[model samples]
Structure formats: structure tokens, C-alpha cells
Target: MIIRTRAGALATTAVLAVTGGLLTATPAAAASVCSSPKWRVQFYANTTLSGTPKATFCESALNQNYGLGDPPGVTLPKDNFSARWTLTRDFGSGGPFTFTAESQDGVRVYVDGVRKIDAWRNVTATQRRTLNLSLPAGSHTIRVDFAAWTGAANVKFTYAPRTASTVDKVRPLAPTGPSVSYDRTVNRATLLWLRNKEMDIAGYRVYRRPATSTAWSRVSGTGLVTSDTYANLPPATGETYLYEVRAVDKAGNESTGSADRSVVSVDRTRPASPTGLTGADARGGVTLRWTAVPDAARYTVFRQKRPVNGEIQPVVEAATVTSPTWTDTTAPERADYTYSVSAVDAAGNASVRSADLTVTRGDHPPAPPTGVTTADSRYGVHLQWSGSTSDDVAGYRLYRDGELAVDRIDRAVDDTTRPYTFAYEDRNARYGTTYEYVVAAVDRSGNETRAAAVTHTTPGDRVPPAVVTGLTATPREDGVLLEWEPNQEPDLKRYDVYKATWLGDGPIGSEDGAWAIGQIAWLNETDTSYLHKATPEGETVLYAVVATDDWGNSRAPHTGQEFAWVTVTELGTPTEG
Candidate 1:
């Protein structure tokens, strides 16, 4: 008989029993002939079920009908026969279950020998009964009894689990008989396990972990697997990995893991090649660097001397290090070499070599310019220095006040000779300002030497203003009006005016002579015109103007012949001055 529980239907065997007493069995009855667990059935000739069973065998289900006829494998009075079915099996984490039965005449159900369903009355139509009960975890037994008294004969009994998540709180039993197989050609592992007996089982989950690690990782996909087998690709690093399976139920509850199955994988993959290789000539050695490779246990650096005149050199191992940088202190000076790097894993698999990098050793900066000197003049500051003695010197660089004033100055042809001299004029320098100058020598390789520096202050302005031009004297009644073009000197202090008397035949007063008026008026730099008032009437007056600077350096005054002379008439009208 297939008895339905909340989890699923379970096939059971029958044990003959009297209506009011337990039936005895021989020792051979303990051994069942069924391939799989099934319902063991027996038929009795009497309705009270009081004698040896006429037939004994196993059937997958209890549903049967015999209308006015006898059941198969038995000869009985079609209307007064009895049958029974029973089974004992594990109910892993059992929970609430419902038992249902329908039969003609009478039928009853029991759990662990306790009567749970009773409908023991003969009926013309099929009688039905259902009972709900809680089944604890572990082994349990179920029994069903049916009797046919008259007319049609039939019986059906089944039970199932209450699969509702809120109703069934028990978890499914753990999957068992787990086994794993590995394929070295593909680096993959396949796991298999016996399915759990729980009919409400949703699926199974497969888990894996390194044999040395305590943590486990789900190898199956995110969704629960609905099959008893799984396939996954484990890392092929020559390490042992453990695999297990777990059962999940429709209620979303999961059981404990099954026994662990382990497999050792073969390693054939190599680490990735290192990249971004570069090299530089350092003070202590030839330093090389490259990008780090994942899963690399160490890096190997290889180098070979550059071909000279088409002659190739054999490559040699430089160094093996765990970091991304290495220094070869034994590298010879003044040589060119090509370098490459490779990564190696713990399994001794080496990756392909990285792209090669070319480097030159013994590259040093040229010597700095020496004998630096500075001199200030009225125009600007002047800088002079001796060229560097180094033959590889490409040019010199100049800096003013810590800023680059000149990018480069080509080396002169005479720079190779003794007493090398170079000069640069900084016209941008201002008067009375202090400045710091630095000079360095650069080589073709872009290496620069220590700068030679000097600090100096520019001299103050001592230059005088230029002579004034466009001097004119207009004869006005009040005085001789004078105006002249303004001087453009930034340091001009003022203008000085002088007056002299002119006779009818010759000039009487001169700028440097005793007959001249020494000075008449002093005007500020912005005042270019001056009015000399109250001059002698009907007389010729001589005028002169000169420019002076802030340092008291004045322009030479006009001589007698150059003075502006103007004659006045009795009406006070000036002729010319």
C-alpha cells in the first residue's frame, strides 16, 4: 500500500493480523523479496481475518477493486475476504501528516501500532476517512486493514506531508552516499548523491572547499539544483578540494551536509607574464621595475648585453625576487643591456617573459659651469661664467631669482679650449634690485648637474638727462613767455631757466659769462613753460633753459650765441627771443 504523508507517499508491506489479535510470523518473514521498499500484502479467506493468509506478496500501492470477484493471487469467497498492508521506514525530521483512506465494507489505519483512523463498518458504497497527526523524526511504522463483506469490493489508502511552510516546520533529511569524480583533461569535477526520501524536497545544494580550509563555498549555481548530480570546475592548482551535498525542502528548510568527498586536481596553468618593465641607472646599481603579476610567488629578471657591431650576447639571469623591483649591483658600468621579467608560481610553472626594455649604464650628468660673475651697468645686469670642463656638455642654463631665465645656451666652438668664457646680458633687470643667478650644464641624456649660484645687487641710476629742445621765447607785455618740449627721462628732477641782456650790436649776458643772470626760475619736471615778467623796456632780453635730473646732474646751459634773444618796442611788443 502507498501511504501518503505530508512529505510524500511511502510504499509499505503488510503483516497479517487478526481482527482482535496480533498475528504470528515465521523467521523467514523478516526477509523481503522486493527490490525497493514496497507494500507487503496478504489476503485472508475469512472476513474476521482469523487464519493463515491465502496469498502473501508485495505491491507498490494499496488501491484495488474486485466487483463480485476475488483479488489476484488469492482464492476467496469474493464477499467475505480481508487484506492488510504494513511498512516500517525512516521519517527524517517528520512533521504534520494527513492519512486518507476509502474502502467498501470497512477500513482502519494505525501509526506505530496506535489506531489513528477507524471506519470499521461494512457499507454498500465506498466509505472514506481522513486523520491529521504529528510524526516525530526517525523511524516509524504504519498499518492499514481493509475488509469486504458484500457486493462490490474495493480499498484505497494514502497519506502525504502537510507541505505548507507554516505547517511543516521539520527539515528534510541530509542527502547521503555522496561520491565525486575528477577529469584531469578538463580540470572539472562531478559530484553525485542519493536523493532524500522526503517527497517535499525542493532540490539539493553542492558545496566545495579547499581541503586545508575550514570554510566552504557553494559550487552550484544560485538556484537550488533539482537533480542528484552536479558538475563544477575547481582551481587546477594541484590542491585537494572537498565536496558535499545538502537537501532542501519545499518549506525552504535545509538539512545538514552529507559526507565529504575529496579530489586532488592536476596543475598545468601558468601565471601571467609581468608587464610595464623599465630600468634606470642608479648610483648603487642598475634598478629594474615592472608591474606585479597575480598569483605570482616570485619574479625572475633576465638581462643580456646589447649587440655590439652585430654580435649577439647570451642572456643571463639577473635576480629572482618576490617584489616588483630589483637592483643588480654587479652590472658593469658604461654598457647597454636589454632586460625582461617573468613570473613563477608555487607549482614551479613559469610564465612567458615580459616585453623587453633597453637601458644604458654609466650615464652621469655633466659638470656645472664655474667662475660665475655678475656686473651691473646703466642698461641692465651682465652675467659671465666659464664653460664646464666636461666634454659631453651640451649647453648651459641660466636662472634669475630661482626662476629659469634662459632654457639653453649652445656650447661655443671655443668652449673646448682653455679659459672658456660665456656671457649673457639680462636686459630685464631693474636698477637697485637684488637678484640670485644660477647656472648649470646639461648633457644629451637630459641629465643636469648641480647649479653654480651667485647673489648680487644692481647699481643705482647715475645717468643724466638729455639736453632740452624746442625752446621758444614770446615777447609778452608782462614777460617773455617760454615753453619747450618735455623731457622723456624717468629720473628728470626739474627745468632751470636763465636770463641775459642783449645789446643792440652784441649779446651782453651769457650763460657762462659775468654779464648773464645766473638763474631766473626753477620749474618742476611737469612744468615745461615759465613766464619771465618785468623785463627792461625797449631792450633785447636773452633766455636759456636747461634740464636737470634727480641726481643733480644738469645739462650744460646754452652759450651766448645759442641764447634766444627778443627785442621789445616802445609799445611793449616783442620781436624775437
Candidate 2:
């Protein structure tokens, strides 16, 4: 319980008063107020006395006690008690006494028969007064009023000297904030708190004990500081600690102990290594499974990317519940990968990592597509392929302008997409401009192979078949002239020209493909030229060719040179188409 007084001071315990008294008490010794009653007083030379009174009283001297008495029955006055003292205790020097009569009971202290302490009641209640005698420091007669009673009679009293020892005062501060907390890294408990408002503080003392124990002893203190921190405390290993702090002020005053707190510190040691790690299929990715260690809080999985030559640095993708299984969701296909696992305790301490488990699966890359690459638009492009993704391919790929344009499975499927296409819509591309293009193939194993291409660009985002090279058509007197520069391709295979009355500038692959006028087959890899004859005069002629590599790479149809325009002496102006 807390005790509070009207003075606003509070404490845990209250001071009790002694009750009852003993009879027939003997007066053992007597003493004086000043040093041996050598009434230290001062007297002025020419101060005359007033009021006519008998000289038997000690007066007109330095009077110390002038009033100590009961009130008259005539009036109910306030508590007015004083001792007139013109006396000074100057460790050594003495001087004159200028005095007056101020008393309580009938006057008993007087000088020259003049009463100083006035009291009309009998049995004085400890009346005291002093006067100046102008005497030396040796000794002097100072009288006291002995009336002890004011109303009902009791025992009389007198004045005596009592030695008083100085009082002790205290001002101490208490520690604040969370006194204790767990240290996750070291698996230990750390205690921290602050001290403030310590006035005249000499030092602080800390005392602590186990919750189950009652004995508390001093632990430590830095004498003075606003705060303190302690860590790595295995004090009593697994038990809780209760602490209190006391402050000692400079004047030997001690403040009572502050509030106490019981703190529990955990031991949080790490768990055992995980076991039985196995891999299984989780959808398209591999699922890694492991046994959870007892007392383990979480598990972490790592992925190791197989390097070209050096050792691989394992990477931890995530940590999860100790169920100990993780789906390798980011697994890469057709490549070697390694893995490892570890167990983490509640304190975040991790166990030694498990042994490395590795697997080598696949190493194949996609086969190169046998196709002709050409730029066909400001961003439009074309590719013609003649190969499959496998000797037994699930699909074949055709790319235009270096982007995948076709993915078809089966040779029969390849035959249907004879012409592959791509159209770029980049805002930064220009119309009627030149660009380069290439094509690569991706296999069933997610592997990509390099390009098989022909370099040819069009007047407007189109590339002609280079294997066809050049061509011309003219109507002569005897017949029509049809000529073509054989494909410069070292693997030139064949050529074919189509003839009809064409409507647009599009090449042979476009709509309205006309009839074939002639076809030529190449016999040598060094063949750089070819020519064909037209079946009729004034006919529109379009030609295209194919170049086949040892690996079956091919080219697409493209516009040959425009040579069908008529030139004649009869017509001075040449007819242009």
C-alpha cells in the first residue's frame, strides 16, 4: 500500500508513534541553552530605561526570550510567543546589549528590579527572556520564567540545551523504457534502460535476482549516466531476472529502490540439419523436398548456376516453412543445375548448409532453319524455310527481320507455310528504306540455332531473292528476249520465270501469280548466270530462283529487273511499264 501525507510526500511505509509512559522518572542531568549559560549579551552605553519597576528584575539588557505565556481571559488572541534577545554569538567578539521586555507569563526576567517576561498566571509554562549585562565573556546572570501552566494545572517546564544532528535529504531517479529484449543474432538476452532526474546524484547501484529467489545483490552501475546497455547475458542460462536500482545523493541521502521488473531471456540455439532432400516433378518445374528438423522454424533453398568452368556460387531464392519442400519455379530447362538447403532457428541462427546435390539433364540447342531472310517493308520482312526442327521435329521455325515469324510442326505443316512473314510497326522505322534481316530456329529443347540467309533489300521495305540475281524481257523481230544473271549463290539449285500480263509491282509470291514461261536447273555450285526464253511477245515476265545448301537451305521469290519495256525506231519515245 502507498502512504500519502497532506504535504504531498509519499512512501511505502509510515512512521509509528511510541505509546504510554513510565512513572517516577529521575532527572539524570541538566544543561543550558548557550555555552555553559555564559549569557552572551551586549549593552549600549547611553540607552535610558522606561516604565517604573523594582530593580530586583534583570532588564534593560539584551533580552532573548521575552514572551512565553497564556492569554488573558479578556480576549482570544493568536499564538504570539517570542524571546527578546539583543544577544549575538560571534564565536569570539562581544559588544553592547540594547534590550526590551517581551514575555508570556508574569515578568520574571528583569534588570535593576525591572520585570521583562510578563505573566499573570501561576505555575509558569516555560517562560524565557534574556537581557544585556554588558559583561565580559566569562559568565553572566540571565533569569528565566518558570511558569509551566496556562489553563488546567500540569507539570512545570524550563529551557535547556540539546545537541541536534543535521538532517538527511534524498533525490534519486528511476530507470525507464523496456528493461530487457532478446538478441536474435547471439541467441542471448540483452537488457537496456535509462536513468533521469537524479539531483546531486553520486552514483547508482543495480541489484538483480532470479524470479524464484528472494535474495538480491548488487550487479553493477557506472556511478552516473543517463542510460546503460548490457548484452550477451547468459545469467542463470534459462531463468528470468528481476532488477532494482537505488541512488545515493551527495549529502549521504539515499532514495528508496525503484520499481522492479522480471525479464525472461530465451536460449534460442539453432536446430539440426535438414534430411531426406529429394527432387520430384512440380508441374513443368522440379520440386525439391526435404525433412524438417525438429525445433526448426524455417528452411531456405539455394540454386547454383553451372558455370562454364569455375565453381558456382549458390543463390538462395527464398525461405519458407520447415515442411522443407520448394518448387524450383524459376528452373531453367536443358541445363545442369545444383541445389542445397539449411535450417534456421527461431533466433535466426542458421545451421551448416547441406551437401551439394547436382543433376545434369540436357545440353542440346535448336537446329538451324534452312531459310532465306529478306527485308520486305519499312518494317515488313519475309522468310522462306525448307527445314524442320528435328530429324523428328515437333515443329519448324521461320524468322523475318531476326524475329520469329512462324512455328509449325511436321513437314506437312511446313509445306502449308511456304511463305513466312513479319511486319514491324516501330515508330522509329522509315519507309522506302533498307534494313538487314536474319532467321534462326528454336528446337523442342528450347535451343536456338544460327541463321541461313540471303542478303537482299527492296526499294520499299522489301528484299529480293539474291539467288535469282537479275532478269530482263524484250520483244525482238524474231522473238522475245528473256535473260537472267544466274544466282551468285555457290549452291545455286534451280530457277523459274513466270510470264503474264501483270497488274502490280509485287513479286511472283503475291496474288495473281501468272503462268510459267520457262524453268532452268543449275548443275554447278560455281554457276553465276541463267537465261530463259518467253513463249509469247509483249508478255509480262517475272522470275525467281532457289539456292540449296548442303544442309537444305533455300531462298524465296523476289522481283527481277524490269526489262519488258518496249524500245523502237518507229516510236521515238520508249514505252515504260
Candidate 3:
């Protein structure tokens, strides 16, 4: 049960009592009156304290005790006695107040003759009863009845408010007419809100929260800003911001927030152009690489194509990526191709195209490497392929389930003309999982032969993987680098890394907090770390990991006891690969 009372210091409990018999006669009026606001007291016979009082007088306060003794004036029974006290006064405006009444035998209180509290009962100890009342403006009568059938006789009455003040009773209404206008030329946003109509309002305060963030912050530094208009706010570029205003009264009561307004500040400045564009003509595709561009959200590749016999056009868009490397697998065989890259900011502003790089495919492409095979064991998938027999052959590239699993073969060969054996272990492949594999043979002149595909299904392994630990994330200019202690489970296939844009109090897939966007990257069982090079700058990124067994069973990162989590702010300098 909730009890609401006026604001004031808490008061101590009151105790009172009366009994079966009272003094038989009245006492002479004391020479001195019972102070200013005294209480009219009366004593009566019978345990119910019914009929009229056998003795009458006035007391300055309720603090009273009548031990084993006769009445000072008239004679009356001592053991069983009853008494009643009445006080009347005019209290101001209606408000929450507390009324406390105590007694040794029994006691009850009445406001304006209406029962407000009742604790009447026979007892060896003093009993106390407190009642909170909302008194109206006017004169009211307060009466307390007490009885003492045995033992000690005592009675006390007191009351006080509960809260420090009644200001909380009033709340300012929400602000209206909220609006935001952004000036692109001046690069500032002006906010306007209707002034609160509350008479006691001290001032207004503005709050701002970034569109991508869940936290809110006060925008004003000075206390109680009285202005209804906030001008010249330079919000962050390339982001949308939310704003609201709240009114605070002089009594320190704050009203609900006003309707929110949102504004988008587009970043019009272009990013630095990517440099060092170079292309290598290889079998089946062209491989391109470039130096990283600072503050570039992503790199857009443009291919220079000749639609007519003589006219050259560089309008053909290729691909976009945070990584600096890209492979064009659709380049026509034995054809010349020119490519260039341009940096794009988050606001879609593009920089000038980098220098052009041209590469001509060789006339004779390398022969397709034959005899591709895979061995699926409980550990992982083991792949083997035959080297190309052409003299211009460079090395092989491997693909898993049609995805570029390995960009290039790691083994070094002294001669390209002779057929040789190439091997790779796909330790990250889970057991009980079927996978398709393909290998391509490329030559020095950027010529290539189509590779034959191979399929293999791993044997099932039921052992669960161990939880990953030592997770650490390092911020970089281009992205976030994550590393963790490798799992020791022999059947561990690979590690799946998950990222969350926000961590506290959010909605996830079927969960209420820590929503995982998706798997950011996968790592081999032996690999301890991975790098993400395209995260947004000035934002914190949260990461978690899960280790999967050969049979596809997984162990998620421990969220308790020892939670494996890493946070990094996007502030790293570009470390181009």
C-alpha cells in the first residue's frame, strides 16, 4: 500500500491508553491555562469509555501517564479507566498530512467527528496508530479516545508531513511546437520549442541524442536557460541527430520531455582519392591493388571501357569495398583492361579517380590444373590439386563452395613448366558438413584456365568446442582488428565473430538486448585474429565470438563469470595490405 503525505520531517510514533473506571468528580480549573492551543480532556467510567466523562480538564499536550493512584479531585476507580481528548483548529489549503494516535489499552481518532484511525484493544504495551489524511481548507475537529484496563496508562498524539515540499504535486505540461531547421550554407541547425505555460517554471533545457546512439545528453551548460529558441548548433556531419526540450520548475520539478525533432547534417566534403593503382593480368581474372585512402568510407572501382572503336569511356562502375584489394574475374580473355579507383565518404561524396592502370591478357592462358581432390576427416577438409604445366603459370587459387577461400597458393615453385603437387588443409571446415571446392591456375601474363570442381563431406564429430578467451580489439584508421586465444578443442572447425552496434538495452533476434547484426568474419581453427577495415569512424564497436565444432555444434562466448568482449573506437590510421 502507498501512503502519500505532505512534505515535512517525519514524526515519532504516538502511544495512548484509557481504562474501565475514571475519576468520579471534576477538578478545579488550574490557575494557569493549558498554554495557547490546549486539548479538552474528559475521564469516564466503564471499559468502553461510553456516556459522559466523570472528570474533565484541559492539557497543553498529549504526553500523560496515570500510575496506581487516586484522582487529584474526585475519587474514582484506578484499575479500569477511559478518557477522551478533543481539539479543533482551522488548517490551511487541503494537503496530505499524518495523524498519529497511541494508547496502552485501546485508542482511535476522529477528524470532524469521522473515524480516521482505530487501534482500540486491551494490551500490556502501548499501541500506536498513524493515519495520513488530505485535509480540506476549513476548521475541523480532531478527537482521540483511549482506555487502560490494566498495567500502565499512557497516551500520546503527534503528526507531521512526509515529503520535503508539495512541489512534486504539480508537473509542467510537455512543450509544444518543437521544430528544427538546418542551414547547409552556415552549417548550423536552429531549434525552436514553445515556452512552457507553468507559472513556476524556472527554465528549459535541451537534450540531444545521436541517431545511431541510444544515450542522451544535455545540450545546455548554463542552468535553467530561459530562451525558447536554441540557435547555431553545429551537429556532427554525416549523421542524424534527435533533440528534445524539458522544463524545470523553481521547485526543482522537471516535466516530461517535449516531442522530439530530427535533423540530418550531410557531409559534402569529398574524401582523399586512393593512389598507387596497379593491376596484374592473371588467368581468368585481373587482380588490382591500391594504397588506402584516409577517411574513405569505401573505395569504388571504375573500369575504363571503349564502347566505340576509338572513343574511351571510364563510366563503367566495377565494385565497392573497404579493403584495398579486388579481383576482376570477368575480364575478357586476351583483352586489354584499364581500371581506376575512387574514394567515397559516408555521405556519398566521391573523390577524383586515381591514376589509370592498364593490363593486357596473355595470348596463351595456363592449362586448367587437373586432378583436384579433397579428403574429409573428423578434423577438416584436406585439398590437393595438380599444378599447371604451362611455362607462364604463376600459382593456383582455391575456392570453397564457389567462394574465394584462398586468394593465392602459398607454396613457391622454381619452375612453372613441370607438373607439381599443391596441397592445402581446410582446417576451418566443420565436420558432418558437405563442401564444394575448385582451384584455378593463373600465369604471369594474367592468363588463366578454368579449374575443375570437387565436393567432399566431412565425417561427423560430436565433441563440443571450448569457449574462446583473451578477446581483444584494437582500433585502426581503416577498421577494427580483433584477436583472441585459440580454442583447444580437437574437433573445433572454425570461429565465428559477431558484432553489435549497441550493447546496452537493445532488441536482438528474439532477445531484448545485445542484438547481433551478423557474423562479421570467420577464422581458421589455427588463426587467432581477423581485421575489419571498413568500420565507421568515431563509433565504438562491440564484438563477440563463437567456436563451432566439427559437427556444427557451437560454444558461444561466455557472457557471465568471464565474458569475452572487446570494444574499440574507430580511430585507427590506415594500415594498407
Assess candidate 3 and give its lDDT: 0.71
Q: Which candidate number would show the highest TM-score if scored against the true structure?
A: 1
**CA shift at 271, candidate 3, in angstroms?**
7.4
Task: Go through the candidates in order and give each one's C-alpha lDDT.
Answer: 0.77, 0.44, 0.71
Give the TM-scores of the predictions, in the order they appear. 0.52, 0.24, 0.27
Write the residue-wise lDDT of candidate 1 on 1-577 in tens digits: 3222222211233333343342322213543443344677777877877787765666677788766666653446647889888777777778788899999879989899999989998898988898888898877888888888888888988878888888888888889899999999998899989888776788998999999999999888789999889999999888899998989888888898999999998876689999999887864467898899888999999999998889999999988999999987666657898899999988788999999998887866765778888997556988888876555567888889888899898745455665377888899987668999998888777778745679989865655577677888777667668888898988888988877654344444544434345687889999889887775376655676777777676654543223333333322545797
lDDT of 3 at 74: 34
The best-first sequence of candidates by TM-score reads 1, 3, 2
Model 3, position 147, has a per-residue lDDT of 80
Sort the candidates on lDDT, descending order.
1, 3, 2
Clashes per candidate, residues 3 or more apart or on different chains: 19, 55, 30
Worst 10 residues of 1 by lDDT: 2-11
lDDT of 2 at 390: 35
- Highest lDDT scorer: 1
Which candidate would rank higher by TM-score, 2 or 3? Answer: 3
Per-residue CA lDDT of model 2 for 1-577, tens digit only, reads 1111222321112222222321111111221133432342211111122222101111223322322211111111112221222212221111234333333343345433345444434434533344443323222344433222233221121222111113223233444453666664464555565543332355556677888898987666444422465543546344577766665554544455667766665645456777777776422356788877876778887777678568655575544656777766445555666777888877687777777677553444544555454445434444444553333234555444566545543334335453332222323334344544444555555566655555554443223235444545445444444455655644344444333344545654487454443334443455544433323344444444444443344443333343232221111233569
Candidate 2's C-alpha runs over 4 A off are 1-232, 235-261, 264-271, 281-283, 294-297, 310-322, 345-348, 362-577
Number of the candidate with higher TM-score, 1 or 3: 1
